[model samples]
Target: MRTVYSEDHRLHDGKHELLEGQFMKVHESPSRADIVIGRVRSAGLGEIIAPQEFGLEPILKVHDEGLVRFLENAWDDWAATGRTFDALPHVWPVPGLSRGALGRRLSDCIDGKLGYYAIDAGTPIMSGTWAAVRASANVALTAQKLVATGEKSAFALCRPPGHHAGSDFYGGYCFLNNAGIAAQAFRDQGARRIAILDVDYHHGNGTQQMFYERGDVLTISLHADPEQEFPYFIGYADEIGAGAGEGYHMNLPLPWGTDWQGYSAALDRAMKRIEQYGAEALIVSLGLDTFEHDPISRFKLAEADYQRLGQRIAWADLPTLFVMEGGYAVEALGVNTVNVLMGFEQR
Candidate 1:
């Protein structure tokens, strides 16, 4: 598998983020990508190449124009406000507000725009965020282009993981929905159907919302139950897609302490649905946060379990693209991550 990455990802490092009403150190860091890249080289997976620029068009395909514009100008706007700290949204319209009232209130308010377009306060936007967000999207697109040309599979080592960002909202350490954008690109390239298997520890609420009403892309997420995880508003099994997308969206919300036996079974069910749907390509939202040693997530998946995880995905026998997402076990990140790719290669 070819690996797509860029050093520019180091630019968007935020100083801190809010967690549980207190400022906490950001778990998503540049060193996570560095360690994973080192493992890719140590394991001899494939060549690592800088991402080719795809411009803003591909990203605009999946994200809102207003949201994109805000991201590009956010740093300058915050600077103009004379705030030296990283900008974060503090206020949000509650559930009962009228749509027009909320829109009017958010339009004239920079702070409101921040909350309107953001789902959580964990992602802080500093001066250098625009460049890195664009670069990360390009990295995912580069891998998509390679996989589309029959490369068997490719790995997009995206930093500040994107499964949590949707078409119009950003949060959970994500700015742009990398996997969602890639899945849409695959469909635009003539693939009749695509399956996005999001195995992150936290639910990929953004990815699900992006395709909730579409049938061309099948999204299956296996994560901690929303009642107990971040992005707790959605990710229920009953949300089985809306119009033409009925039965296309699947959510397997497991409990916090799930082991490989339980996790693998959920994965098997996800793969079976993909087989039945006859998807032309497979996009795996590969988040290693499910690792037992991860500091920010729950689940008991050991390093060896990742190897099995890859082996099982190989059984599906489709063109696969693994887009990196969340994982916070810094020391074991490389070995645990590379093990998945190695298992797939050997399989």
Candidate 2:
């Protein structure tokens, strides 16, 4: 598989993020991509290339205009407040806080706007965030274009993992939904239907919301039950899309200690649905956080399991785009991620 990456991913490095209740070092770091890319080269996976600029039009396809503008100027708006640390939202409109009262263009109210636009406190905005965010989207888009135009498959080594970002909100160390953007790009490029399979340890709530009401893009995720994981909403099996997308969405929530035996059944079920959908292409929200050693995530997947996972995905025989998402076991990330890619190639 051809890999698309960018060095600009190093720019959005936030010093800390709120995990659980305490502030901790950001698990989603530039080094995650560094390790993955280094392994790709060392293992002779395939050619590595810089991302080509696709501009904002492709991003706007799956994101809100106001949200895009907020991400663009968020740093400057926060810096104007005279504090110089990473900008994080201190409040949120959760459960029942009268969210309808918030205005759309609150550029003058940075804090309020920050809360309105941000879904969680884990993602922070630094001086170079927007540049890196834009570049990351471009990275996913470039690799997506390669597959959409006829390559068998490609890898989008996106940083600041995106499966947790929604159309108008950013969090879970994600600013934009890279996998969502790529699926939208395929739609804009004329493919009638596409399926996104998220194998991340956490539910891809953002990607699910992006396509929850649209049938053209089918989204499926396998992750720890929301009752026990972060982003504790909307990953249940009951949220099977809405309106035209009624039957297109699926979620297979598993227990915390799940290993290969329990996980493979879900993968088989997900692949069966993708087969039923007959999508023209597939997007795998490739996240290796299910590794046994992941710091924050729970699951018992071993290194060898990733190869089987990739082999199962390859069995579908559709053009695929592997958009990087989350994986926090830094040392083992490269081996597990590359294991999936290598397995796909060998399969």
- In order, the Cα lDDT scores of the candidates are 0.91, 0.92
lDDT (10s digit) by residue, model 2, range 28-97: 8889999999999999989999999989998898899989999998899889989799999997666566
Candidate 2: worst 10 consecutive residues by lDDT? 98-107
Cα RMSD for candidates in order:
1.3, 1.5
Model 2 CA deviation exceeding 4 Å by range: 99-107
**Each model's TM-score?**
0.97, 0.97
Tens digits of per-residue lDDT for model 1, 131-167: 9999999999999999999899999999868999999
